[model samples]
Target: MADLVYYVAVTLDGYIADSDHKLDWLMAFPLGDDATPYDDFYRTVGAVIMGAETYSWILENSPEAWPYANVPAFIVTHRSLSIPEGKNITLVQGAASMVAAQARMAAKGKDVWLVGGGKTAALFAEADELQRLFITQIPVVIGAGIPLLPVSKVLNLKPVTQKVLKSGAVELVCDVVVG
Candidate 1:
């Protein structure tokens, strides 16, 4: 079974983006570690699932034609969207359970990454479907924006790995105890 890992960057107060859905705040910080972690993550991720908000944000901001060129990505959205031709992307519309089932099926041997905005991650985390959470805490704090995680409930996680980068960003790897 593939573990669903939520890998994301958050601020000190826990925001994924600003009010305008711009990640300029994230870019303000000096680049911390290289793509080693992302590379390692991609190696283990056979498929990825993300919220519409996050997907749209990347589509609008990413410079590359298709940021997730090789990898298969699924975006959960209510609105109809035409995924760019020749891209390994899918659109899934349904409840969290349905989405998880589809993502798991696609993941097969590798892991499924829940790359997203707070609602998606929080839903997976609440459902106990999110197996692991790898958060890279950047050394910056935006007074207000989208929070990294939802403020609805508390999630109990066990620390498995911890690494502090030279740029003061700390990467925390934790396991989501799902029954």
Candidate 2:
């Protein structure tokens, strides 16, 4: 069995993006030699699960050549969507449990990655489906925007690893202690 890891980048104030769904602040923080985490993740993770909004944001912001070209991705969306040809993108609707199940099945022997959108991550977090959270906090404050984690009763996490980069970015890898 593989664990579900939510690896995402966030601002100092815990915002993943601004109110307009713009990652301009995040754009300023370069990934310089920071591909190690993502590379390792893609290597170990067989599938990715993301919300429709996050998927749309990627499609709108990402390069012409999709980043997750080889790995399978499940996009949870309410509206109809089409997966680009030759790309391993699947569309699913309804609840988070169903999508998480689908992602687990698709993951095979490798881990499952819960990518992007604070609400989507919160769903898995609330359900106690997510095991780990790898957050690379960029040094910037968006003031107000989409939070890195949705408002909830209470959530606890214990740090497992930490790393500081030359760009002043800090990465915290923690295990979720769901109650």
Candidate 3:
């Protein structure tokens, strides 16, 4: 079975994005490595899941034409969203477990990327479906913003890998000890 990995960038204070849901703060960081961590991770991911807002944000902001053309993407949303032509992106609304199951099926033994804002990621974590978490800790502190993991409950994670990226970002890869 493929592990569900929560790959996300966060501020030092543990914020994923600003209140406006902007990742501009993360984009400005200097990536010193020639190889991108995302590219390597993307190869292992067959499916991606995110919240409605995160989906819309990527649609509006991503410079690429189709970032996940080959990967299946599931967006949890109540509101209708515009579909990008020739992309395998689906809008869904349901219990987190349902979404996780669908994503796992789509993954076909590959990994699932639980990508999103705090609340959406929290949903998977709460369901105990998210097995791994890769946190790119950028050296910044956003006083007020969307938290990295916003859950009423706590999930314990044990570090499997930790390294300082060429971009000066601290990457902490952890196995979900108890989700």
Candidate 4:
């Protein structure tokens, strides 16, 4: 079975994006190298699960070619959104448990990446499908924006790994201790 990993770049104030659903602040931070420190961890990802808002945001912000071309990507959306031709994107509407099951199949024994939208990740967390959280915390505090996890849930995480980047960001990998 593939594990669901909610990997995100968050602000010190626990935000993934701004109020207007922009990541410009997060993107402005220097990454320093050609490849991020998370590259090794990302290499194991086989599929991606994201929310409708995240999907729409990516469509608006991403390059001409979809970034997750090879990776099987599933978008959780109740709205009737159109997927561009030649893109391998699947829109699903259902409970998180059902989506997680489908995501496992799509993952093909590799890890399933919980791509974006904190609310969507919260659904997975509530379903007990989220196994880990790899959060990269930037030094700056934006004060207000889209939260890290909109849905409230107590998570007892056991630290598995940690890394501090040259850009003054700290990345922490932890196993969610599901109780």
Judging by lDDT against the true structure, name the best candidate.
4
> Tens digits of per-residue lDDT for model 2 on 101-137?
8888888978889987899888888888888988989
Query: Tens digits of per-residue lDDT for model 1 on 1-179?
Result: 88889898888788878877888877778755553456877888888899888888888777478777767889988888868778889888877778888888877878888988888888888877888988888878788888777836677789998988888888889997655
In terms of lDDT, which candidate is stronger, 3 or 4? Answer: 4
- Off by more than 4 A, model 1: 33-36
Give Cα-based local distance difference scores for all models.
0.82, 0.84, 0.86, 0.88
Better of 1 and 2 by TM-score: 1
Question: Model 3 reaches what TM-score against the true structure?
Answer: 0.93
lDDT of 4 by residue, 50-124 (tens): 999999898888758787898889999999998988877899989999999998898889999999799999999
Better model by TM-score: candidate 1 vs candidate 4:
4
Full candidate order by lDDT, most accurate first: 4, 3, 2, 1
Q: Which candidate ranks first by TM-score, i.e. highest?
A: 4
Each candidate structure's TM-score, on Cα atoms with residue i matched to residue i, is 0.91, 0.90, 0.93, 0.94
Pick out the ten consecutive residues of candidate 1 with the lowest summed lDDT. 31-40
Give the Å shift of residue 155 in candidate 4.
1.2
Name the weakest run of 10 consecutive residues (lDDT summed) in model 3: 29-38
Q: Candidate 2: deviation at residue 12, Å?
A: 0.6
lDDT at 92, model 3: 89
In the range 1-179, model 3's lDDT, one tens digit per residue, is 88889898899998999988887888898757742467898999989999988887887888477678898999999998889788899898888889999999999999999888789998888988889998889998888899999877878889998988766778889998872
